[model samples]
Target: MHSIPKHMPTSTVVSASRGRSAQEDPWWVRWTLISLSVLVLSVLVILPIANVFYHAFSNGVAAYWNNLTGDRETLHAIQLTLFVVPIAVCANVIFGVAAAWAITRFRFPGRTILTTMIDLPFAISPVVAGLMFVLLFGAKGYFGPWLQQHNIQILNAWPAIALVTTFVTLPFVARELIPVMEAIGSEEEIAAISLGANGWQMFWRVTIPNIKWGLLYGVILCNARAMGEFGAVYVVCGRVIGKTETMPIRVNTLFEGGTSETYSSSFAVASLLTMLSLVTLFIKIALEHKTQADLKEAAQTHQTE
Candidate 1:
């Protein structure tokens, strides 16, 4: 009787065969899927971005430049976006790092609940988040009377914009860090503590270095979202032309003006946002490659040891 080969298990052989069969699609089917994907991508992404730039510079490059800088409201919207995004990103970074550290390093009750809550923004609509803030701080909201008595403004102000932005971007950093931290495990941290390092030193020296790439990845995503947010900001900001209007809100306002100039200005502002997204994409890709390289090096070092 023939004996079974020692190198390949029965289960492995069966799974390999199954995988091969699954991948054995006809040549036409494979090409058709690839063609469909490219077509869809061109329609959904490539064409829209190209169209924006086309209209933005339809008159001339000078027109696009003038629209971006000549308009006071557009300039203010750009400035407001610059101001708000940093505050939101900083707040989220602090919260994200602390939350990721806790969730990864300890065992406690309600951990699952805490994890779920981190994902709440993704599950819920930004519009709902905006409405929730309005309900709490708007002129006729729950605290509206108290706010009015004190002559304090939350809704329709920069503060409301910042707060809503922070809420919407709350998860990016933590979500990126959690799996990274979990995969790396706590052995290095434990070893550091054992070697007479203090808690802060251990975190700054060991943990931060280990997770820096992931942290940067998360910050990029958070910054992108904070800059591009519309619905939540719109609801709370009340689209007060210059003061509370962000770049996205400015784009919408210009688009609705229903004139050749306004249309050109809108696309010009949109092109700036698109350019930012493209830059972010490039940086994100570079970080991913760096991260994978670090991971591979670590794995190789471990094997040698």
Candidate 2:
């Protein structure tokens, strides 16, 4: 130590230099990271939101409010949207829970194929989704004759419109629930049965509690997707103005006609959608917390018993 080497070994110098290089990220690297983050915000988020709010408020808040309140068509659209969103979401909720049960709880033949079939909508074109109904319920569709003969009136009808929208969104609830269900497994179900719980009781008490968050989150997604549905609904709906036109269809019509006022009113309507999305976001957060708390509580209760 007293006679420390006059010159530090070459290896020591190189090692110290490498450490310094690791500690100090290059300016280019930092700049690239910052640029990417800013670009993501600029393109994906900021632009669309800017466009919506800009058009919505272009005529000032007073005009927006007046349009929302006085326009019968707009008012009807909002009402119809509220009416359809819940139905579609609820349909997805029951079906999704059922699908999750079949896929996770029981082993069935063609299960993988069925799972893929369930996800088919995600891959198919929305226009195709709409066209499918057109083929099925349109004047020349496979079932069109029978349906028309029965006076079904699915084409250009709200129920028809709602069905198409529901079809497109059915996957939402299922996709959300499946993963969470896989994570949960049948342990709790088996546990419940071990304690003398019957099938109905086990599902109502154990299964529902465990997957409630998944269901809630899926509902939020389904509702949002359904409310904003355009593709399949438009094809089947005939955009029958006061009867079957959804908010998105209205925006397209207004934009095509170059009606600034109508377009702006449409955005105000879209702002209603935005409000729903925000509410969904909040609900998702709340469900996450509730699920975590429930799991922790169950764990503590289990330990004590």
Candidate 3:
């Protein structure tokens, strides 16, 4: 019989392996990576926002205030944004919940196709999406004659703006909820139904409570995108100054004015959008923390049970 080599001590072998595998990186390499990350962040994110605020107030506080509140065009733009964002967000919430529920809980033909189609907005360009709407609703479009015959306007109007905003933001809520719903599974819902609850009762009493954080997360993201959308809105809004201009469109119009005052005004309006984004970011972070805490608590409860 062949003699086997003696085994090394477990502690010695483990220590040798750890020494080889887990040695700390040279100090300079670590610092270089951290410095590079900070530099890129400053260049890409921090500087642009700071520049916007600087130019926004360059003409002084009075000018900034006047640009935001006193300017008729800016006010109209803000009003249009307010009107469109809510409609888009509300519509998406209903569609999102339904899509997520159908997808996560049921098996059906073309389900894969449906899920793929939900991601179409992300795959397609927003500008192209806007152009598609324009082709469908513009004067030479297929429905154009019918629309014109009825004296109904769709393109170059708020309706077109609302439609495009809804289209672009369509995926946000559904995308956010799909993974969340899948992770949660349907056990609670099945149990609720077995306990004598109806469909609506189970959804409202059980499913909604479970997915509330994820739903809120989706809504916040959807709202942010709806408010800040520029490419599609710009294409369809026709930049009709005070009439159809949203905030982003208004910024473009002001910058195109080619004057120092207009430049300041453009930055002023941009500052508002930036502030909205920052507020959304804050809410998103808080929701994430809440979600993690809830998940941990649920895990503990499950283990105990």
Candidate 4:
């Protein structure tokens, strides 16, 4: 048995003294929460981004414009980022899709071990990832001397940068697509096969359409990571100024070099990246909404039928 206090509710008694409400979450609490959130955001994300934009655009609109369109080295760095992002993302996309399919469709020895291995990069430091390639491909590395004798140069080259980026970003696409694939199940695929659909047709019609959102989500995330990869690229590519410098590597060099002229360009690149990330975020949201809407329409159609 329980007893309600005399001052408390029989059927929600109203308190007329001191204006205290029955609910604990008052307007003051809400405002307090909003204020706290604004404070933290102002310190963390907003401030940093504002600083970048301020530096990027501070020297007037024309200077920001010139930061991008005027500098050849900066232009080259941007091109390198563009080139590496696609290659790294595509490699990861293929491997990730395959890995997801393997995990969902088959039972095999060391499957759990392999899945854990996929998450290794997430746990380990990026500096260690660079060291891994360095140990494998550096001048006196395990096979480095042997290869170098024959004029082979995997390290300090674009291939090394691309490979390292691909390896590091590999887990992103698979991580995104795996749960979606597991939830969707292979029943539709089996059904497509039973109805005499070919492999390509079944995949295109049944497999891709369902998981397209997840795939896109993974690709966007991976591209973001690949574009900004620095430690590994620095180690492997040797930061050869205009040649091997991606956006991040270029920014670090500019920061190190004290190039005031390049600071705005760095911020411009950063802002460009931020814009791409926002676009990716929107795509993910739109796809998720569309997927939900499609599911609802399907349920309605079935119910009506």
Candidate 5:
């Protein structure tokens, strides 16, 4: 012991040597790599966002303010986006929790097929997604006659927009939840049951807390997609000036030729979408950190137990 063991492990020596080698890299090389990464990020992401802001205010703050405040269509577009985002997010949350719980908590035939079906939206184009709904609800659609009899409006309406948006963004939450639920396992639920917790109690107290971060991550992604949805919403919306147009559609409309719309108006609306994306990024990063911390805490707790 006093001699610190003459036969020290070779593995330890090798690891120390590797660590030293890694730490010995020149400071200039490290800085060069970091600077390169930052430069690339600035070009790919920052530059475009800067361009949007520049164009949005090119005519000055008064024009930008008027584009937002004086435009009824723009206001409706914002309202429509706000409406769809919450509803779509809520629906996806319910579907995600149910689907994830069903898949992870139970074993049954066709489970794989069911999961593949859930991911079909991701595989298909958003335009195709809109087309599917159109076929189901259009005037000549399968339920078209029934819907007509019932005086139901789906195509070129808010209903169609919501439905198509839902279809396109359906996979996010369930996809996020499946892996998390699998890793956490059923042991906690079993234990909670043994301790006299009911189904709802066990889920609310044990499962929800563990999966909340992943769920939040999924919801954020879903919300972003729902709000930014263009192809599907555009297809089904019929671009009704103020009734069914969302922020994306509004931005697109603003740039159409033969219209009185200016580049500033279009870019101004676009900046809103860009800002939403930035906000989503911020939330996602924060949630990722929180998720990592929770995972570490859970691991430590499990080890202690």
Candidate 6:
């Protein structure tokens, strides 16, 4: 039998015998923390959403429906959001996959610079990101004269809206994919190549399945931001109602117009946005749980192998 070392604290020895049970917080402390979190979420998130639905339908269903459907501008804003989100999501997905593949699979000069460039959009203010496009495409901008001479319209146009939305949402997919790709490594990719699989086939068979969840996670985040983007889109849109207005802009327009139904219309449109956020939250939570399960399964598989 060995004695406890003289340097070892008596408290530490007692705690070691008690194991992890010794470190557990008192039940009241844990319950207090749980109560605080619930209270905060109820006040901040749940209450606001409930209020949006309340204000939205207070005047009745027809009034709410008319606010969304009767106004041509509101309809157009909806259409515009529908148009921009898909295109931006597709573009980002393509760029994200390519960039992640290259960055994770290759070692090269300027690799760090390239990664930094990918993250620049996230670091910059959305307003500043929108301004960069304006300075590039505005009438007095560098290519503005040439564009005008060519009769090309970008500023205050759908293209400008898409461009700014894309800029503001650039990092989501790439950020999601990089770590997954890094973890999966190139072992399977090398094996596929040796077995005569083409690059596309290798990606389809080996890479995609490994990273599909991550890709989906990224796409979800990218889509949420693309649809919800306001600041960058606001600057680039010139707030041309019915033409360039997105859902967020439409909500702002209604609130600021100061009519009898202004509050109703704004909140009604805002209710649509709030619904979108709630849907996004649900999807994100589901994906997070799925990802955790996948990670756990993969770890277990690795250990077995």
Across residues 47-154, which tens digit of lDDT does each residue of candidate 6 receive? 999999999999999999999999999999999999999989999999999999999999999999999999999999999998999999999998899999999999
TM-score for each model: 0.90, 0.83, 0.90, 0.84, 0.88, 0.90
lDDT of 1 at 164: 92
Model 3 residue 204 distance off true place after TM-score fit, in angstroms: 1.5
lDDT of 2: 0.81
Error of 6 at 214 (Å): 0.7
Error of 3 at 182 (Å): 1.2
Question: What value of lDDT does candidate 4 attain over all alpha carbons?
Answer: 0.81
Query: In model 6, where do residues sit more than 4 Å from their true spots?
Result: 1-21, 297-305
> In terms of TM-score, which candidate is stronger, 4 or 6?
6
Superposed model 4: Cα runs more than 4 Å off: 1-24, 291-305
Q: Residue 236 in candidate 6 has what lDDT?
A: 91
Q: Write the per-residue lDDT of candidate 3 for residues 1-305, one digit (tens) a residue.
A: 13433575567766886788677687799999999999999999999989999999988899899888988999999999999999999999999999999998999999999999998998879999999999999999979999999999999999999999999999999998897777677878899999999999998999999889989999999999999999999999898989999999999999999998888899999999999999999999999987777567656656766
Highest-scoring model, lDDT: 1
Q: Tell me the lDDT of candidate 1.
A: 0.92
Runs in model 1 lying further than 4 Å from the true structure: 1-22, 294-305
The models' CA-based lDDT, in order, is 0.92, 0.81, 0.91, 0.81, 0.89, 0.90
lDDT of 1 at 136: 95
Error of 2 at 127 (Å): 0.5
Candidate 2, TM-score vs. the true structure?
0.83
Score candidate 6 by TM-score against the native.
Answer: 0.90
